[model samples]
Target: MLRAGQAREDIKVVSFDVDGTLVSPGFVDCVWLQGIPKAYAEKEGLSFEQAFEYVKSEYDKIGEHRIEWYNIDYWLRKFDLDIPYERLFKKYEDEIMIYEEVESVLAVLEEEGYELILSSNAANEFIEFQIEPIKRFFSHVFSATSDFGEVKKTNGFFARVCEILDVKPQAVVHTGDHWVFDFLNPRKIGITAYYLDRARKRNVTDEVRKEDDEFVISDLSELLDDPDC
Candidate 1:
C-alpha cells in the first residue's frame, strides 16, 4: 500500500486504452486491413489488391482519430459489406491478446488499490467479444462509442470520462500508445499522461515539441519499477 504522502502523489485513477496498450494491435490490424479486404474481394468479385485499394480509399476519408472511423457499424453500413464486423473480429479473437506483463502489472496496481479503468475507442461489442479475457481486471470498462459517443482524441472525451468517474483530472493518470489521443489530450486537461512506446517509436506531438520532455514507458512493468511516476 502507498504511504499517506505517496498516495497523494500517486494517481488516484489509472486509465488505459485497450488496443496497442493493454493488448497487441495485431488482431485489429488483421481484421481491418486483411480480413475485411478479403471479404470485400469475395463479395465484390474484385481481385484482392483492387478490393484493398477501394477499402483503403474510403477508409482514409474518415481519418483514424474521428469517431466515425472507429465505428464498426458505420464502416459496415458505409462499405455495404453484408458481413457483420463483429464476426470478422471474432474470427481473429485468438490474436487479440494482452501483453505478457499486463496481468502482473494490473495485479500489482490492484493490490495497491488504484482505481483501474479501461478506456478505449474500440466498439463495445469488440471489447466484449475480443478482449473479454482481461475484462475481469479492470474496475470499469469504458468504450468511446458505447459509453460516450466520443473519441479520446479530443479534450471533451477526457472531460466526459473524468465526469463519469467523478474524479478531478489532476488525480488521474492515463497511459496508452497513441502520442496524440492518449498522451497529449489528457495532459492538456491536467491529467498525467504516460506514452506506452513499446517499440521505442518517435512520436513528437505539438506538446512534446514545446515541453521537450514526455513521460514514456517501454513496458508496463516499468510502472511498477518507478517509485515516482
Candidate 2:
C-alpha cells in the first residue's frame, strides 16, 4: 500500500497498453479490421465478404504476434493498396477515444505520484494520434515499432522497456487487455501483471482459475481499489 504523499517507490512505473486498455478499439478496428477489408473489396471489385475472408487469411499467415502484423506499410505493399496509411487513420481519428474510467484512474495514479507510461504494441504514429486526449497523464510513451523494433508478444520487448526506463523489471506494474503480451510476458520477466478483461471474454477453465499470476479484472477502477497494486 502507498503511504500518504509517497512518491510511489513501491511501484516505480505503472505502465499501460494503449489500445483496448486505456483507449477504445474503435480506431484500430476501423482501420485494420473494417477499413482495410472495405478498401480491399472496392479495390478488387469483390464483395465485402470475400475481401474480409481474404484479409483474415492474410492476417492469419502473419499472425498478430509478429512485428509485421502491426505495420501499415507492410500491409499496403502486400495488398497493393494505393492509399496513404495516414489517410486511413485520419478517417477514423474522431472515433479514437479513451475508456470512460481511464482519465479518473490516471488522475488518481498521478496524484499518488506514480510514474505513468504508455507501453503499447501499436505503431508510434498511431499512439501519437490516439493519446492526444490523455497525453498529459503519461510521462512517456513506448511503442513496439518505433521504440522496440519488436512486438509486445516478444519477452524481449518488455525487457527492453525496463532497460530503457532504467528500473528493475519488478518495479513496473503493467495493465492491459492481452493475456499474453500484457500479463504473461511481463510476469515472466518479473513485472507485476494485471489482465484487464473488461468483456469477461476469457474462458475460465479449472486450471486458469488456479493460476496466481493472472490477476483478471473487468475495469480500470478496480486498480484504484486494489491494495496490492
Candidate 3:
C-alpha cells in the first residue's frame, strides 16, 4: 500500500475504473438486470424474481455473448420492456455512491499534481450518474460505450488514452479492482498498474498474483500514506 506524501516523479497521469474502484457498495448490476427484467415479467404475468431468473438463464445460454448485449438499453429491449431510458436512469440514480475514502484520496492526488481521468465500462447515463458527486476531482471521464465502443480490455483502448493524454504508456498508473480488466491488460501495454483489492478478491492467476510493476492496495487511503505513491 502506498502512503501519503510519497511522490513518484515519473508518473504523470492517473486513470481509474468507476464501479468497484471508486464506489463503496460497488456498481449494481441489478439496476439494469432486476429492474428491466422485473418490468418485463409483469407484462408477461410473472413475478420479478421469476423474470430475473429467466433472464439470467437466457444470459447463461448466450455465454460470452452476454457481454455484448449487457448494456441498459439492450437488456430493456431484449426483455421486451418498453420503459423509456429516462425513467430507468432516474430510478437507479440515487443508488450510485462513491466509496467513503475515495473523494479525499482523489483530492490529495490532485493536490500532488497528478492528472486524473476516469476509464469505465459503464454506460454513459450510468457513468454520468456515478461521477456526478466527484466530478470535480477528474480532468476527464471516458466511457467504454461512448468513447471506445467497448471495454478497456479491448485492443487499442489504452493506446487511445495515451494519445489523448499526450503521455507514454509507461508514465501512467491505472487503478481498479478487477485484476484482468484493470491491472493485467494495462500492464501489458507498458503502463504502471495498481490493483485495488477492496472486496478482497484474490488473483487466481500467476500473472496477477506476482508482483512486477503492479502494486496492490486494500484501500485508496494507503496512497496518502505511502512514500512511493
What lDDT score belongs to each candidate, Candidate 1 first? 0.78, 0.83, 0.73
Which portions of model 1 miss their true places by more than 4 Å?
1-10, 203-214, 226-229
Clashes of 1: 0
Task: Evaluate residue 209 in candidate 2 and report its C-alpha lDDT on the 0 to 100 scale.
Answer: 58
Instruction: Choose the strongest candidate by TM-score.
Output: 1
Better of 2 and 3 by lDDT: 2
Evaluate residue 4 in candidate 3 and report its C-alpha lDDT on the 0 to 100 scale: 22
TM-score of model 2 (CA atoms): 0.83
- What are the RMSD figures for all models against the true structure? 3.5, 3.7, 3.4
RMSD from true fold, candidate 2: 3.7
Candidate numbers, best lDDT first, in rank order? 2, 1, 3
- lDDT, residue 86, model 2: 85
Model 3 accuracy (lDDT, Cα): 0.73
Residue 63 in model 3: lDDT:
56
In model 1, state the lDDT of residue 133. 73
lDDT of 2 by residue, 74-144 (tens): 99889999998888988898899889999988999898888899888889888888889789999889887
Q: Tell me the tens digit of each residue's lDDT in model 3 across 1-229.
A: 2232224577788889888788744346656575677787888989888887898887777654345554667667777778876786677767777888988888888988889998877667677777788988888887766667774454367778888889988778888887777877888888777888876666536554454423777787765555544
- Which is superior by TM-score, 1 or 3? 1
* lDDT value, residue 146 of candidate 3: 66
